[model samples]
Every structure is written in structure tokens, then in C-alpha cells.
Target: MGEVKVVFQSVDEVMDYLKALEGYSGDLDLQCDHMIVDGKSLLGILSLGVNRLLNLQIYSDNYEELIKKIEFCCRG
Candidate 1:
């Protein structure tokens, strides 16, 4: 699995991020504190609260393409 921290500045960003995630066949999840939700679900991602860095867990070894697609949203 691969992990990264990302932040959604607006609803559009969230939508775009979800779109990127949906293209991948691997499992993707977003976590906030003790809460975890499906990354591809618009409602699930919106429920995580905005303007905060979220922990993204990509559950697959062959997730390089997916990661590259969403790297713009990731924070170093």
C-alpha cells in the first residue's frame, strides 16, 4: 500500500480528485483522525471536512499511475 497526504481546497478539487481515483482499479481510502471513508465517493469525501490535509491510503502495489494522476493534490 502507498500513503500520501492531500488537501482539497474546494468542492471542485474534491470532485477532480475523486475522478482521478475512480480511474484506478485499486482500493482507495481517505482517513481523518479516526474516520475512514471510500475515496471515490463524493459524499464520503465531502464528509471528511475541507481545507484540511487528509491522509490517503492507496491499497495496491501497482498504483503508480493513480498516484501520478493525483499528485497535484498531494502535499509534501
Candidate 2:
């Protein structure tokens, strides 16, 4: 398991991240307050009310690449 901290600026970025994550075969988890959702779910991510200081956990052999892709959204 790997953990990364990131902030989402908009819904579009989140959608992009989700799209990129479609290629990853891993268990990705995003947590905000007490809510936990799949990192690959656009609807699930949007419902978190994520704005800043969101911690994402990418679990799998490809976690390093997944983290990089998700970090891409922080800039968007």
C-alpha cells in the first residue's frame, strides 16, 4: 500500500483522474474525514466534497504509477 496527499481543484480534474485510473488494476482508496470511496469512481470522488488536503491511498503493485496519475489532477 502506498499513500499520497493531494488536493482536487475541480470536478473535471477528478473525472480525468478517474479516466486515467481505468487502466489500473488495483485497489485505490480515497479518504476524507470519515468517508471512504474508491479512487476510480468519479461519482464517489465528487460526493466527498474534496477540495484541499485530501489523502489518497493507492494499493497495488502499480501504486507508484497510480499516485503519479492522481497527482496530475492536483494541478488541474
Candidate 3:
């Protein structure tokens, strides 16, 4: 699994991120505190909230494209 800390600047970006994730057929999850949601789902991502640190877990070995799409959102 690949893990990264991410922060969404706005709802639009979250939508874009999800769109980018759509091409991948893998399990991706976003976790904030105790809440965890599917990375590819807009509603699920929104539930984790925005502008906060989120732990993104990428379950696929082939995640270069997905990572590239959200690299800007990475926190440090």
C-alpha cells in the first residue's frame, strides 16, 4: 500500500481528483481522524472534509497516474 498525506483545497478539486481516480480499478481510501471513505467517491471524499490532513491509502501497485493527479494536494 502507498500512503500519503493530502489536503483538498476545494470541492472542485475533490471532484477532479475523483475523476482521475476513476480510471484505476483498485482500492483507494481516505482517512481523517477516525473517518475513512472511498477515494474515488465524491460524497465519500467530501465526508472526510476539506483543507485538513487526510491519509490516502493506495492499494494498487500501478498508481502512478492517480498519484500524479493528486500530487499537488499532498501535504509535505
Model 2, global lDDT: 0.74
How many steric overlaps are in each model, in order? 0, 0, 0
Give each model's whole-structure lDDT: 0.86, 0.74, 0.83
| Overall local distance difference test of candidate 1 | 0.86
lDDT per residue as tens, model 2, 1-76:
8888767788777777778777678787878888888877777788887576667887776677766666675432
Ordering by lDDT: 1, 3, 2
Top lDDT hit: 1
Report the lDDT tens digits of candidate 1 across residue range 1-76. 8898989999999988877766577888999999999988889999998898899998999867777898879996
Model 1: colliding residue pairs: none
Best by TM-score: 1
> Higher TM-score: candidate 1 or 2?
1
TM-score of 1: 0.91
Question: What stretches of model 2 exceed 4 Å from their correct place?
Answer: 74-76
**Decreasing TM-score order of the candidates:** 1, 3, 2
Model 3 has how many clashing residue pairs?
Answer: 0
RMSD of 1: 1.1
Off by over 4 Å in 3: none
